[model samples]
Target: MASDLRTQDIQNPVDVAEYLFRRLHEVGVRSVHGLPGDYNLVALDYIPKAGLNWVGNCNELNAGYAADGYARVKGISAIVTTFGVGELSAVNAIAGAYSEYVPIVHIVGYPSTASQKNGMLLHHTLGNGDFNVFSKMSKEISCAVSLLNDQHEAATLIDNAIRECWLHSRPVYISLPSDMVQKKVDGDRLKTPLDLSFPKNDPEKEDYVVDVILKYLHAAQNPVVLVDACAIRHRALDETHEFIVKSGIPTFVAPMGKGAVNETLPNYGGVYAGDGSNKGVRERVEASDLVISIGAIKSDFNTAGFTYRISQLNTIDLHSYGTKVRYSEYPGVRMNGVLKKVTAKLGQLNVEKGPKPNNDIPDEEVKSPEPTITQAWFWPRLGQWLEKNDVVITETGTANFGIWETRFPADVTAISQVLWGSIGYATGSCQGAALAAKELGIKRTILFTGDGSFQLTAQEVSTMLRNKLNPIIFIICNKGYTIERYIHGWEDSYNDVQEWKYKELPYAFGAEKDSVLTYRVSTKKEVEELFLDREFASGDTQKLRFVELVMAWDDAPVALKSTAAAAAKTNAEN
Candidate 1:
């Protein structure tokens, strides 16, 4: 990869900011998300110099959210903000990343080292003269924190922070002092890139765990492989897929694990969220003699409000950190190596004769005289309409629960926050996801979000249009927070939202008249016709597509109704 472009020589020195950003670029961060501020302005200069684009966000929170989406797609992402006000605004997003295991590098530009040490009155500060307050608040959520206050250890500190962020697959904090931005650091260190490889699991233990799993796997009359969020977040899909394909066992996923398994495979079943499962899927999964769960998170939403009837005595849980067979715990027995060994050592299994799992989408109703769109009809229909390799993002409301009913195409990437149910996240995340897809030359990036939640970060569409990122945005105009109403206050006005001309947004966002396509579909017929349109449904990634899909405000998906009821019972409100 050497070139005559006269890149920073290994023998020479590079500025601390340059070292930090170059390391980010090395790990596939093509764009840095954040807002420009006085303290961070100079450090932002190094972004482009280090072969990265500066994605200026309208707000700090959206920047962090955008970074989360970018990391979900690109493996890792970074964001730069000012010392106090900016970093604090982004703390919620960073916390969300930490909760959901999204790797993001949160870089904060501080006042000069001298000013911080001498307690100079800084505008962004809390005026208490305690400069470390914000970083201290962030330390709880971040796996590692690096304060680049000194030039001597800047390079090493930066490398450590980035490594921890990637290794844990969580957010990390790196505070860069304004004065230290240009401080010289050894550029030779960059020649030998950060050791980003994961430590190998002890082979003996991994194989032993694999044997235990296989013992049950072989004896079971009926077995099912359950893939979940950690399977993807922990980067174990390669091994999981190998085991699923090799074992030929019926495979299913938790809601958070949607898109983890390829639905095109005969062995691949639909989602299994306890009572919220796809028709026969629940009965089939629960009836299995042994349930092989991989990186599964049994969260409230993930397990249909923890209604998983599968017996712990019949389940073997394989996780990133450890393995659990029945009730016996095998701590430190990671799944990646164990699954790989299982797949390699596996022989013919006695797969009990049973009805094969099917993700059958119901035929559209042609006799609906009123042609009203319902959640049940929309979700399953979406399964039929989705194409391969598309990146689909769902917001934390109805769109999130509704998407569980849909089956994804092969290699399709599904992004949503089930663990951290943040309302406004998808819009900002879509902006980042679309840009990431664009950078990878992917044809389409689609987003489904409630109009209420979209309003929280609606301005992010402007950011997408400004960057010329073409994402198909579906703003489910259900009038208000339907999910919230379903959970509590069904008739309360607080659950309502103000309406907007969502379809006209592209034009208002400065997109060229012909550069974007807008649609407002109220009836089932309109939706069917829109999906059937060759230009709209085809892989026409050239134009931005925004759709306003109107639905009944009181309506919710079957999963949402049950999940919300369970949630309400578990946590009583005032």
Candidate 2:
């Protein structure tokens, strides 16, 4: 039944913007986080009309961090802002996303063609140009950079940028000029659809590498596989689980990679960080003849300040970017190959059957038994309280340490910008994470953040209240910048911050005091009491529970020494 009808036409620019926004919506991006400015005015106007919410961020860095956190839960996220200042401020978060393999789309608005010819000093304009701005800052962090000059290029470039983000598991930048965003083009040209593909292990390379990996696996008396954050970002969870089960190898997750494989599995050892590492896990990792690190980044913090004295030769590094195979007496081979090659080879190894050590260690030896009342003490307890259905969001500072120290059960989800290391991220991120949790029907959304970080995006509490989200937020009240004090060797004034009545935040934000529980804990006993009481329960009324744990500003966690050492090493390298 072929029929011809008269078609109603809209301007090209409006149609292009609508098409791009629709695609983003199709991809599960609920909102775009950024600050509005002159260059991006048109797009900002088009956002609501296109049915996408605009999350107005206080600053660009926080906006980017929020987007990263959102992506961690939603599979993808986006941020939009103006030229130079906005873009530059967001570099830290974008770079962090790149390092951690978070898929995000960054849309920057540039000056129009007429303005460039004027040669006057424009807001957010560098002496150079918008192209140079994106070129220099976006090269390493973004998988692709597209300039929206021709209206015809809008759909294609936007689609390409989005595709690159999903393919590479990294951020991509798209620069939209003011003029192009308002100009019209043939709407018929915007019909190119997007294609989504899952990353596969290279079959050819797998055959060869698997052979090499199996040789070592068969010869080793004790072999273990270590999974890290990269495994989670690369969608290798099922593959990792299958490998663990088939190989029957003991598995341990790095601090960042916790919960990638089921923590409750018979062969699973808990996280390997500070107090979380059981004596059994430590011994197993040290005693292994071959240690296969799958998508692991052995950061000094995660590895006890690089104190795990593994012979460089006994290590096999399998990462998303590349692989490194080392031997005691020979130079190692670093190659760009698919993980399937090695996994398939290792699959053939004989399954070792026995009751292995549980890798649990006594509290005193594993960590200082004395309570420091710092964020570290809070994490393990929080981890224990968290259920598989819970989603934990951590802010920068002690909250990050909390995440580093905590162990999540198989279904528990966690999100943080560890690489970006931006302050105030967790506060706003909790909002986005909470929204995602609600959409996904996840119960018990929790946030652990520092007082300093909370101040950066405290306004989001209103958003949480308005949305009727039940998020239990624990604010570590050690004054301010606890992490910076350690990094800067206790630069007292710079690191110290003024105190606020932490428990009153929810009430100030118009939440019911009874429903929104608040606690002030100064000792370990207090912490135990509150957690055991379950004062911050979710029910008919959405709750905003705030737990203020008191500690000394200069009373750094033991892990700070490793951070300081790393800083020293970085300074020396520079």
Candidate 3:
């Protein structure tokens, strides 16, 4: 570990930028996402020299989105942008990362300290001579904020900022003044890696909570484990999976928890979304005498607008912040440690092989005689085409709701923004996710988005084409916002959008003619034919595939229709 310290002494220090990028590389950020701006250009140059790839995006917002996607896969990601114009442009994406608990280091380039002290108005500034405004705005979304002023304190500030980002699994803001980019700082700090270990739990509380959980878990006639998105965020998926395997209990995943656990396991039940859950998922989960929910985030969309019927008294909710056993709550109880302890103790307990819930995925039923495309017909067929280790990114509207019907193979990763509900996020995130997969040796990157959402940030596809990253994209051409129609207005003109030739988008976006494959399927037969093609299902990395699946505007997934109705009713009642 001493060799990890710089070969040179503190007297021969490296610039602040070099030190920061090296630290990021040590923490597992292989690539940095951002667009070049004057203030940050010098610091951006240090990225490649630090052994990190500089992924230049088309815009700052997309760069932020890309960073979030990369962080979800790589554990931590960094993004660099220029002053007010560039940093402020990424606010929405940063806020989404904050809400969903993604760790992203947002490094912004600021004017020199002398200019700030002299009250000089800069181009990116608001002309009010106030350079602190943007940093103040960022304080609301980031878990930590640091503006490096003195060279002596720069190393400590940078270390603390990154430490906070990893500890909380949230975004952190760092403003690097132009003058400080090349300032000498201690390189000896690099020898010692940042401390990433979780805090130790209170021994007394840990024993008491574990006993309480074991009491209910052992006494219950039928027990189930429910996995959610927080399990992924908190790095407890592996522990959660181990607990399920050792306990031999039935398990179900929430909507946001898709792909966290392998669904191919014998005791794995389908998704549990209250009324929207697969055939027997809701019934089996609610019927259980004890429910051990891990990393649960019960949002409106995730729960189908509060349609769940499970009793609070019968549930033990384990969260990142704490643990709850029926009525009593214990704060600061880490699930990371708790899950480990539970898994280790599972072998000693008398756990049962509970009754298996309905794990069958039924065949698609045909209702339309004319072979027209429909949600009931499309989602099931798509499920058959999915392979192991394929990463799927779903857009907010129809794609998010419809993907709930999907069944993933083992090791597949599913990424979505159910809680933030951001439109046009998938297109930007696909570019990053594909790159991340390639870095991690993952093969296929598949994306599903409605036409309305695609129109918002379609240009990111150009970035993908430029990078030669192959991601299979499906654009659901429904002519308008179908989810919005179900939520507020069924026939209002406000939900309509301008129609474009969806299949020709790749060509228009600069993809080589033979390098990419494009398809337009209007009927169920056409979709089936394309899906069954030998080359199309091969998960090829050399070429990209784009498909436009046209469907009826009014038709939607059964889950979406019911959830929309509930949301609409709530709106009317309020």
Candidate number of the best lDDT: 1
lDDT of candidate 2 over 308-360, digit per residue (tens): 65665888777655566674211122222334445555545644432342323
Return the TM-score for candidate 2, rounded to 2 decimals: 0.84
Assess each prediction's global lDDT (C-alpha) against the native: 0.89, 0.70, 0.86
Worst 10 residues of 2 by lDDT: 1-10
Per-model TM against the reference: 0.96, 0.84, 0.95
Give the alpha carbon lDDT tens digit for every residue of 473-571 in model 1. 999999899989988999899998889988887788788998888999999889989989887876665788899999999889888999999999988
lDDT of 2 at 134: 57
Deviating ranges (above 4 Å) for candidate 1: 1-11, 353-367
lDDT of 1 at 354: 34
In the order shown, what is each candidate's alpha-carbon RMSD?
3.8, 5.2, 3.3
The residue pairs in collision within model 3 are 4-191, 5-191
lDDT of 1 at 565: 95
lDDT of 3 by residue, 1-574 (tens): 4433532446658899999999999999998988888998889889988999888888999988888888887889999999999999999999999999999999999899999999897799999999999999999999999998766789999999999999899999999999999988878788899998879789889888888898888888888889999999988888888888888788888989988888778778878889998766887889888899998888888898889888989999998889999999999998878888877876454443433433133454554467788887777677778888998999887788887777777888999998888888888888888889989988889999999989888888888888888899999999889999999877889898899988788898887899898889999889879988888878754788888889999889888888888889888894
Rank candidates by TM-score, best first. 1, 3, 2
